[model samples]
Target chain A: MNKCHITNEIRKFRFLQSEMTQQELAEKVGVTRQTIVAIENEKYSPTLELAFKIARIFNASLEDVFTYNA
Target chain B: MYRKEKMILASLLATIAVFAVYSLYVYQHYVVPKPEIIHDFSFWGKSFLFLALVMVAAQIIVHIVFAIINKIVTKKDIPVISDEMDKIIELKSLRVSHLIFAGGTFLAIGSQAFGIQQWIMFAKLFSSGFIVTILSDITRISLYRKGL
Candidate 1:
Protein backbone atom coordinates (compact mmCIF):
# COMPACT_ATOMS: atom_id res chain seq x y z
CA MET A 1 0.00 0.00 0.00
CA ASN A 2 1.20 3.45 -0.83
CA LYS A 3 1.56 5.80 2.12
CA CYS A 4 -0.08 9.20 1.97
CA HIS A 5 2.01 12.02 3.39
CA ILE A 6 0.50 15.34 4.28
CA THR A 7 2.74 18.35 4.71
CA ASN A 8 1.93 21.80 5.96
CA GLU A 9 3.27 25.33 5.77
CA ILE A 10 2.08 26.12 9.27
CA ARG A 11 5.48 27.48 10.29
CA LYS A 12 5.62 29.85 7.38
CA PHE A 13 2.13 31.08 7.96
CA ARG A 14 2.71 31.34 11.68
CA PHE A 15 5.78 33.48 10.90
CA LEU A 16 3.81 35.64 8.51
CA GLN A 17 1.06 36.15 11.04
CA SER A 18 3.05 38.38 13.44
CA GLU A 19 5.30 35.49 14.53
CA MET A 20 2.59 33.59 16.34
CA THR A 21 3.84 30.91 18.72
CA GLN A 22 2.80 27.28 18.46
CA GLN A 23 1.09 27.58 21.81
CA GLU A 24 -0.92 30.55 20.60
CA LEU A 25 -1.94 28.73 17.46
CA ALA A 26 -2.77 25.63 19.44
CA GLU A 27 -4.99 27.59 21.79
CA LYS A 28 -6.72 29.24 18.85
CA VAL A 29 -7.33 25.85 17.21
CA GLY A 30 -8.33 24.15 20.47
CA VAL A 31 -5.53 21.60 20.43
CA THR A 32 -2.47 21.04 22.56
CA ARG A 33 0.86 22.57 21.61
CA GLN A 34 2.32 19.11 21.22
CA THR A 35 -0.25 18.48 18.50
CA ILE A 36 0.84 21.59 16.69
CA VAL A 37 4.45 20.47 16.91
CA ALA A 38 3.52 17.06 15.52
CA ILE A 39 1.63 18.60 12.61
CA GLU A 40 4.46 21.01 11.87
CA ASN A 41 7.02 18.21 11.90
CA GLU A 42 4.91 16.13 9.46
CA LYS A 43 4.66 13.43 12.06
CA TYR A 44 0.88 13.46 11.99
CA SER A 45 -1.98 14.39 9.72
CA PRO A 46 -4.81 16.50 10.99
CA THR A 47 -8.41 15.70 10.17
CA LEU A 48 -10.19 17.77 7.54
CA GLU A 49 -12.05 19.79 10.12
CA LEU A 50 -8.89 20.61 12.01
CA ALA A 51 -7.09 21.42 8.78
CA PHE A 52 -9.82 23.82 7.79
CA LYS A 53 -9.79 25.38 11.23
CA ILE A 54 -6.07 25.96 11.01
CA ALA A 55 -6.28 27.49 7.54
CA ARG A 56 -9.12 29.67 8.69
CA ILE A 57 -6.99 30.86 11.56
CA PHE A 58 -4.31 31.96 9.09
CA ASN A 59 -6.92 33.58 6.87
CA ALA A 60 -6.03 31.20 4.06
CA SER A 61 -7.56 28.36 2.16
CA LEU A 62 -6.77 24.77 3.10
CA GLU A 63 -4.43 24.47 0.14
CA ASP A 64 -2.42 27.39 1.38
CA VAL A 65 -1.82 25.67 4.70
CA PHE A 66 -1.54 21.99 3.75
CA THR A 67 -0.49 19.82 0.84
CA TYR A 68 -1.07 16.13 0.21
CA ASN A 69 1.67 13.88 -1.21
CA ALA A 70 0.96 10.37 -2.35
CA MET B 1 8.74 15.24 26.84
CA TYR B 2 5.11 16.08 26.50
CA ARG B 3 2.97 15.92 29.60
CA LYS B 4 1.04 12.95 28.28
CA GLU B 5 4.25 11.07 27.60
CA LYS B 6 5.52 11.84 31.07
CA MET B 7 2.25 10.61 32.50
CA ILE B 8 2.53 7.35 30.60
CA LEU B 9 6.08 6.86 31.83
CA ALA B 10 5.00 7.49 35.36
CA SER B 11 2.16 5.02 34.97
CA LEU B 12 4.54 2.40 33.62
CA LEU B 13 6.80 2.87 36.63
CA ALA B 14 3.87 2.80 39.01
CA THR B 15 2.58 -0.43 37.50
CA ILE B 16 5.94 -2.14 37.85
CA ALA B 17 6.34 -0.92 41.39
CA VAL B 18 2.88 -1.98 42.42
CA PHE B 19 3.22 -5.39 40.81
CA ALA B 20 6.58 -5.93 42.48
CA VAL B 21 5.36 -4.94 45.91
CA TYR B 22 2.13 -6.84 45.62
CA SER B 23 3.80 -9.98 44.31
CA LEU B 24 6.36 -9.86 47.11
CA TYR B 25 3.68 -9.45 49.72
CA VAL B 26 1.66 -12.29 48.30
CA TYR B 27 4.71 -14.57 48.10
CA GLN B 28 6.02 -13.92 51.59
CA HIS B 29 2.67 -13.85 53.32
CA TYR B 30 0.70 -16.52 51.46
CA VAL B 31 2.68 -18.61 49.02
CA VAL B 32 5.65 -19.29 51.30
CA PRO B 33 3.63 -19.87 54.42
CA LYS B 34 1.04 -22.15 52.82
CA PRO B 35 1.99 -23.52 49.45
CA GLU B 36 -1.21 -25.56 49.44
CA ILE B 37 -3.25 -22.36 49.09
CA ILE B 38 -2.25 -22.40 45.43
CA HIS B 39 -4.84 -25.12 44.92
CA ASP B 40 -7.60 -23.05 46.46
CA PHE B 41 -9.79 -21.47 43.82
CA SER B 42 -11.09 -18.91 46.26
CA PHE B 43 -7.55 -17.86 47.05
CA TRP B 44 -6.83 -17.10 43.40
CA GLY B 45 -10.10 -15.25 43.04
CA LYS B 46 -9.46 -13.11 46.10
CA SER B 47 -5.90 -12.37 45.04
CA PHE B 48 -7.04 -11.26 41.59
CA LEU B 49 -9.74 -9.09 43.07
CA PHE B 50 -7.50 -7.44 45.60
CA LEU B 51 -4.73 -6.91 43.05
CA ALA B 52 -7.14 -5.18 40.72
CA LEU B 53 -8.46 -2.90 43.45
CA VAL B 54 -4.98 -2.05 44.61
CA MET B 55 -3.88 -1.30 41.05
CA VAL B 56 -6.76 1.08 40.54
CA ALA B 57 -6.10 2.89 43.79
CA ALA B 58 -2.38 3.12 43.10
CA GLN B 59 -3.00 4.55 39.65
CA ILE B 60 -5.29 7.21 41.04
CA ILE B 61 -2.81 8.17 43.72
CA VAL B 62 0.06 8.19 41.22
CA HIS B 63 -1.78 10.55 38.92
CA ILE B 64 -2.63 12.91 41.73
CA VAL B 65 0.92 12.98 43.02
CA PHE B 66 2.25 13.41 39.50
CA ALA B 67 -0.07 16.32 38.85
CA ILE B 68 1.07 18.07 42.02
CA ILE B 69 4.74 17.50 41.27
CA ASN B 70 4.30 18.59 37.68
CA LYS B 71 2.64 21.80 38.77
CA ILE B 72 5.43 22.59 41.18
CA VAL B 73 8.25 21.77 38.77
CA THR B 74 6.90 23.09 35.50
CA LYS B 75 4.74 25.83 36.97
CA LYS B 76 2.25 25.05 34.24
CA ASP B 77 -1.02 23.21 34.55
CA ILE B 78 -1.12 19.86 32.79
CA PRO B 79 -3.46 19.65 29.85
CA VAL B 80 -6.62 18.09 31.17
CA ILE B 81 -8.38 17.92 27.86
CA SER B 82 -7.35 15.43 25.22
CA ASP B 83 -7.28 16.55 21.62
CA GLU B 84 -7.99 14.61 18.43
CA MET B 85 -4.44 13.34 18.12
CA ASP B 86 -4.53 12.10 21.65
CA LYS B 87 -7.72 10.19 20.93
CA ILE B 88 -6.26 8.55 17.87
CA ILE B 89 -3.14 7.52 19.73
CA GLU B 90 -5.21 6.14 22.56
CA LEU B 91 -7.39 4.08 20.24
CA LYS B 92 -4.42 2.67 18.40
CA SER B 93 -2.66 1.69 21.59
CA LEU B 94 -5.83 0.14 22.92
CA ARG B 95 -6.21 -1.99 19.83
CA VAL B 96 -2.67 -3.30 20.19
CA SER B 97 -3.14 -4.09 23.83
CA HIS B 98 -6.40 -5.86 23.21
CA LEU B 99 -4.84 -8.10 20.59
CA ILE B 100 -1.98 -8.95 22.92
CA PHE B 101 -4.37 -9.69 25.74
CA ALA B 102 -6.39 -12.00 23.52
CA GLY B 103 -3.30 -13.94 22.61
CA GLY B 104 -2.36 -14.16 26.24
CA THR B 105 -5.78 -15.49 27.12
CA PHE B 106 -5.45 -18.19 24.52
CA LEU B 107 -2.11 -19.24 25.95
CA ALA B 108 -3.48 -19.26 29.45
CA ILE B 109 -6.40 -21.45 28.46
CA GLY B 110 -4.11 -23.72 26.52
CA SER B 111 -2.00 -24.25 29.62
CA GLN B 112 -5.06 -25.52 31.44
CA ALA B 113 -5.94 -27.79 28.54
CA PHE B 114 -2.50 -29.35 28.67
CA GLY B 115 -3.09 -30.59 32.22
CA ILE B 116 -0.97 -27.94 33.85
CA GLN B 117 -1.49 -27.40 37.54
CA GLN B 118 -4.45 -25.17 38.43
CA TRP B 119 -2.09 -22.75 40.06
CA ILE B 120 0.02 -22.58 36.90
CA MET B 121 -3.06 -21.68 34.90
CA PHE B 122 -3.89 -18.89 37.29
CA ALA B 123 -0.29 -17.76 37.20
CA LYS B 124 -0.42 -17.70 33.42
CA LEU B 125 -3.50 -15.56 33.53
CA PHE B 126 -1.95 -13.19 36.03
CA SER B 127 1.30 -12.97 34.11
CA SER B 128 -0.57 -12.28 30.89
CA GLY B 129 -2.53 -9.52 32.56
CA PHE B 130 0.65 -7.96 33.85
CA ILE B 131 2.29 -8.17 30.43
CA VAL B 132 -0.75 -6.61 28.80
CA THR B 133 -0.70 -3.70 31.20
CA ILE B 134 2.99 -3.00 30.63
CA LEU B 135 2.74 -3.37 26.87
CA SER B 136 -0.22 -1.03 26.67
CA ASP B 137 1.69 1.71 28.43
CA ILE B 138 4.69 1.07 26.22
CA THR B 139 2.52 1.21 23.11
CA ARG B 140 1.08 4.54 24.19
CA ILE B 141 4.50 5.99 24.92
CA SER B 142 5.88 4.85 21.58
CA LEU B 143 2.91 6.21 19.65
CA TYR B 144 3.23 9.53 21.42
CA ARG B 145 6.92 9.67 20.65
CA LYS B 146 6.97 8.39 17.04
CA GLY B 147 3.53 9.64 16.07
CA LEU B 148 0.82 7.67 14.27
Candidate 2:
Protein backbone atom coordinates (compact mmCIF):
# COMPACT_ATOMS: atom_id res chain seq x y z
CA MET A 1 0.00 0.00 0.00
CA ASN A 2 1.22 3.47 -0.84
CA LYS A 3 1.41 5.50 2.36
CA CYS A 4 0.26 9.05 2.00
CA HIS A 5 2.24 11.23 4.37
CA ILE A 6 -0.26 13.07 6.52
CA THR A 7 1.58 15.24 8.95
CA ASN A 8 0.47 17.78 11.55
CA GLU A 9 1.87 20.85 13.26
CA ILE A 10 -0.05 20.18 16.49
CA ARG A 11 3.07 19.99 18.65
CA LYS A 12 4.34 23.22 17.17
CA PHE A 13 0.98 24.90 17.49
CA ARG A 14 0.57 23.67 21.05
CA PHE A 15 3.92 25.13 22.05
CA LEU A 16 3.20 28.45 20.32
CA GLN A 17 -0.12 28.75 22.15
CA SER A 18 1.45 29.40 25.58
CA GLU A 19 3.07 25.95 25.65
CA MET A 20 -0.26 24.15 25.94
CA THR A 21 0.06 20.59 27.25
CA GLN A 22 -1.38 17.59 25.43
CA GLN A 23 -3.80 16.89 28.31
CA GLU A 24 -5.19 20.43 28.12
CA LEU A 25 -5.62 20.19 24.35
CA ALA A 26 -7.30 16.81 24.69
CA GLU A 27 -9.73 18.16 27.29
CA LYS A 28 -10.50 21.23 25.20
CA VAL A 29 -11.02 19.05 22.11
CA GLY A 30 -13.01 16.36 23.99
CA VAL A 31 -10.48 13.65 23.24
CA THR A 32 -7.87 11.69 25.20
CA ARG A 33 -4.28 12.77 25.64
CA GLN A 34 -3.15 9.60 23.87
CA THR A 35 -5.08 10.76 20.81
CA ILE A 36 -3.24 14.09 20.88
CA VAL A 37 0.04 12.20 21.11
CA ALA A 38 -0.97 10.02 18.18
CA ILE A 39 -1.81 13.04 16.03
CA GLU A 40 1.37 14.90 16.99
CA ASN A 41 3.54 11.85 16.20
CA GLU A 42 1.63 11.14 12.95
CA LYS A 43 0.65 7.68 14.19
CA TYR A 44 -3.03 8.23 13.42
CA SER A 45 -4.99 10.59 11.28
CA PRO A 46 -7.73 12.57 12.98
CA THR A 47 -11.19 12.64 11.49
CA LEU A 48 -12.42 15.79 9.77
CA GLU A 49 -14.58 16.81 12.76
CA LEU A 50 -11.73 16.12 15.20
CA ALA A 51 -9.26 17.96 12.99
CA PHE A 52 -11.54 20.98 12.93
CA LYS A 53 -12.00 20.81 16.68
CA ILE A 54 -8.25 20.59 17.23
CA ALA A 55 -7.54 23.50 14.87
CA ARG A 56 -10.20 25.53 16.61
CA ILE A 57 -8.54 24.89 19.94
CA PHE A 58 -5.18 26.03 18.63
CA ASN A 59 -6.84 29.04 16.98
CA ALA A 60 -5.50 28.00 13.57
CA SER A 61 -6.96 26.97 10.22
CA LEU A 62 -7.32 23.27 9.43
CA GLU A 63 -4.79 23.53 6.60
CA ASP A 64 -2.35 25.22 8.94
CA VAL A 65 -2.70 22.32 11.40
CA PHE A 66 -2.56 19.33 9.05
CA THR A 67 -0.86 18.77 5.68
CA TYR A 68 -1.51 15.85 3.38
CA ASN A 69 1.47 14.85 1.23
CA ALA A 70 0.72 12.29 -1.42
CA MET B 1 -5.23 4.21 29.64
CA TYR B 2 -8.97 4.03 29.23
CA ARG B 3 -10.67 1.91 31.86
CA LYS B 4 -12.78 0.20 29.22
CA GLU B 5 -9.71 -0.86 27.28
CA LYS B 6 -8.15 -2.21 30.43
CA MET B 7 -11.37 -4.08 31.18
CA ILE B 8 -11.34 -5.59 27.70
CA LEU B 9 -7.75 -6.72 28.15
CA ALA B 10 -8.59 -8.34 31.46
CA SER B 11 -11.68 -10.04 30.05
CA LEU B 12 -9.78 -11.32 27.04
CA LEU B 13 -7.06 -12.75 29.23
CA ALA B 14 -9.61 -14.49 31.44
CA THR B 15 -11.42 -15.88 28.41
CA ILE B 16 -8.22 -17.20 26.86
CA ALA B 17 -7.19 -18.80 30.13
CA VAL B 18 -10.56 -20.52 30.44
CA PHE B 19 -10.33 -21.65 26.82
CA ALA B 20 -6.84 -23.06 27.35
CA VAL B 21 -8.01 -25.12 30.29
CA TYR B 22 -11.04 -26.29 28.35
CA SER B 23 -8.84 -27.24 25.39
CA LEU B 24 -6.72 -29.41 27.65
CA TYR B 25 -9.81 -31.14 29.03
CA VAL B 26 -11.15 -31.73 25.53
CA TYR B 27 -7.82 -33.10 24.36
CA GLN B 28 -7.60 -35.56 27.23
CA HIS B 29 -11.24 -36.69 27.38
CA TYR B 30 -12.44 -36.56 23.79
CA VAL B 31 -9.37 -36.74 21.55
CA VAL B 32 -7.47 -39.28 23.54
CA PRO B 33 -10.37 -41.67 23.96
CA LYS B 34 -11.30 -41.67 20.27
CA PRO B 35 -14.82 -42.89 20.92
CA GLU B 36 -16.31 -45.13 18.27
CA ILE B 37 -19.28 -42.86 17.65
CA ILE B 38 -17.62 -39.69 16.46
CA HIS B 39 -20.95 -37.91 16.32
CA ASP B 40 -21.66 -38.30 20.02
CA PHE B 41 -24.06 -35.42 20.55
CA SER B 42 -24.14 -35.74 24.36
CA PHE B 43 -20.36 -35.52 24.61
CA TRP B 44 -20.19 -32.43 22.45
CA GLY B 45 -23.15 -30.83 24.23
CA LYS B 46 -21.55 -31.26 27.62
CA SER B 47 -18.27 -29.84 26.33
CA PHE B 48 -20.00 -26.76 24.94
CA LEU B 49 -22.01 -26.32 28.12
CA PHE B 50 -18.84 -26.37 30.21
CA LEU B 51 -17.19 -23.82 27.96
CA ALA B 52 -20.20 -21.53 28.07
CA LEU B 53 -20.35 -21.77 31.86
CA VAL B 54 -16.69 -20.88 32.21
CA MET B 55 -17.03 -17.89 29.90
CA VAL B 56 -20.02 -16.56 31.78
CA ALA B 57 -18.25 -16.97 35.09
CA ALA B 58 -15.14 -15.28 33.79
CA GLN B 59 -17.14 -12.29 32.54
CA ILE B 60 -18.92 -11.93 35.88
CA ILE B 61 -15.67 -12.15 37.82
CA VAL B 62 -13.85 -9.67 35.60
CA HIS B 63 -16.64 -7.12 35.78
CA ILE B 64 -16.87 -7.36 39.56
CA VAL B 65 -13.13 -6.97 39.93
CA PHE B 66 -13.12 -4.02 37.54
CA ALA B 67 -15.94 -2.35 39.44
CA ILE B 68 -14.12 -2.78 42.72
CA ILE B 69 -10.91 -1.42 41.27
CA ASN B 70 -12.73 1.50 39.76
CA LYS B 71 -14.23 2.39 43.10
CA ILE B 72 -11.09 1.88 45.14
CA VAL B 73 -8.26 3.08 42.94
CA THR B 74 -9.60 5.81 40.68
CA LYS B 75 -12.25 7.18 43.06
CA LYS B 76 -13.58 9.07 40.08
CA ASP B 77 -16.26 8.32 37.54
CA ILE B 78 -14.44 7.34 34.34
CA PRO B 79 -16.16 8.37 31.18
CA VAL B 80 -16.58 5.83 28.41
CA ILE B 81 -15.92 7.63 25.18
CA SER B 82 -15.40 6.11 21.76
CA ASP B 83 -13.53 8.39 19.41
CA GLU B 84 -13.12 8.14 15.64
CA MET B 85 -9.59 6.79 15.88
CA ASP B 86 -10.84 4.07 18.23
CA LYS B 87 -13.38 3.02 15.63
CA ILE B 88 -10.70 2.96 12.96
CA ILE B 89 -8.47 0.85 15.15
CA GLU B 90 -11.35 -1.55 15.81
CA LEU B 91 -12.05 -1.84 12.09
CA LYS B 92 -8.44 -2.56 11.28
CA SER B 93 -8.06 -5.14 14.04
CA LEU B 94 -11.33 -6.86 13.15
CA ARG B 95 -10.39 -6.98 9.46
CA VAL B 96 -7.14 -8.72 10.37
CA SER B 97 -8.83 -11.07 12.84
CA HIS B 98 -11.44 -12.11 10.25
CA LEU B 99 -8.54 -13.52 8.25
CA ILE B 100 -7.90 -15.96 11.07
CA PHE B 101 -11.44 -17.28 10.87
CA ALA B 102 -11.20 -17.54 7.08
CA GLY B 103 -7.91 -19.40 7.24
CA GLY B 104 -9.14 -21.72 9.97
CA THR B 105 -12.24 -22.63 7.97
CA PHE B 106 -10.12 -23.31 4.88
CA LEU B 107 -7.75 -25.45 6.90
CA ALA B 108 -10.69 -27.37 8.40
CA ILE B 109 -11.99 -28.13 4.91
CA GLY B 110 -8.52 -29.12 3.72
CA SER B 111 -8.20 -31.53 6.63
CA GLN B 112 -10.89 -33.67 4.97
CA ALA B 113 -8.49 -34.33 2.09
CA PHE B 114 -5.97 -35.72 4.58
CA GLY B 115 -8.48 -38.21 6.05
CA ILE B 116 -8.15 -36.60 9.45
CA GLN B 117 -10.47 -37.97 12.13
CA GLN B 118 -13.89 -36.36 12.27
CA TRP B 119 -13.61 -35.62 15.99
CA ILE B 120 -10.23 -33.94 15.59
CA MET B 121 -11.49 -31.90 12.64
CA PHE B 122 -14.53 -30.84 14.64
CA ALA B 123 -12.34 -29.79 17.55
CA LYS B 124 -10.11 -27.77 15.22
CA LEU B 125 -13.11 -26.04 13.72
CA PHE B 126 -14.58 -25.24 17.14
CA SER B 127 -11.35 -23.97 18.68
CA SER B 128 -10.60 -21.77 15.68
CA GLY B 129 -13.43 -19.39 16.60
CA PHE B 130 -12.11 -18.88 20.11
CA ILE B 131 -8.56 -18.46 18.82
CA VAL B 132 -9.71 -15.76 16.41
CA THR B 133 -11.44 -13.90 19.27
CA ILE B 134 -8.39 -14.06 21.52
CA LEU B 135 -6.11 -12.93 18.71
CA SER B 136 -8.45 -10.09 17.81
CA ASP B 137 -8.53 -8.77 21.39
CA ILE B 138 -4.73 -8.99 21.55
CA THR B 139 -4.44 -7.07 18.28
CA ARG B 140 -6.84 -4.38 19.50
CA ILE B 141 -4.87 -3.91 22.72
CA SER B 142 -1.58 -3.73 20.85
CA LEU B 143 -2.91 -1.17 18.37
CA TYR B 144 -4.29 0.96 21.20
CA ARG B 145 -0.89 1.03 22.90
CA LYS B 146 1.37 1.34 19.81
CA GLY B 147 -1.00 3.17 17.44
CA LEU B 148 -2.85 1.72 14.47
After superposition, candidate 1 runs with Cα above 4 Å error = A1-4
C-alpha lDDT of residue B38 in model 1: 94
Model 1 Cα lDDT, one tens digit per residue, A3-60: 3399899999999999999999999999999999989988889999999999999999
Q: Sum up the clashes in candidate 1.
A: 0
Best by lDDT: 1
What candidate 2 gets wrong by more than 4 Å, as runs, is A1-4, A16-19, B1-5, B25-39
Q: Write the per-residue lDDT of candidate 2 for residues B1-148, one digit (tens) a residue.
A: 6665797798898888888888787768776888554578577678878888888988899888888888789895555576777788789778977899898888887898999866676677677878887888888877776665
* lDDT (0 to 1) per candidate: 0.91, 0.81
Assess every candidate by TM-score: 0.97, 0.79
Work out the iRMS of candidate 1. 2.9
Q: For model 1, what is the error of residue A5's alpha carbon versus the real structure, in angstroms, after optimal superposition?
A: 0.4
Q: What is the lDDT, from 0 to 100, of the residue A48 in candidate 2?
A: 90
Cα lDDT tens digits for candidate 1, B1-148: 8889999999999999999999999999999999999999999999999999999999999999999999999999888779999999889878988898888888888888788888888898899899989998998888777876
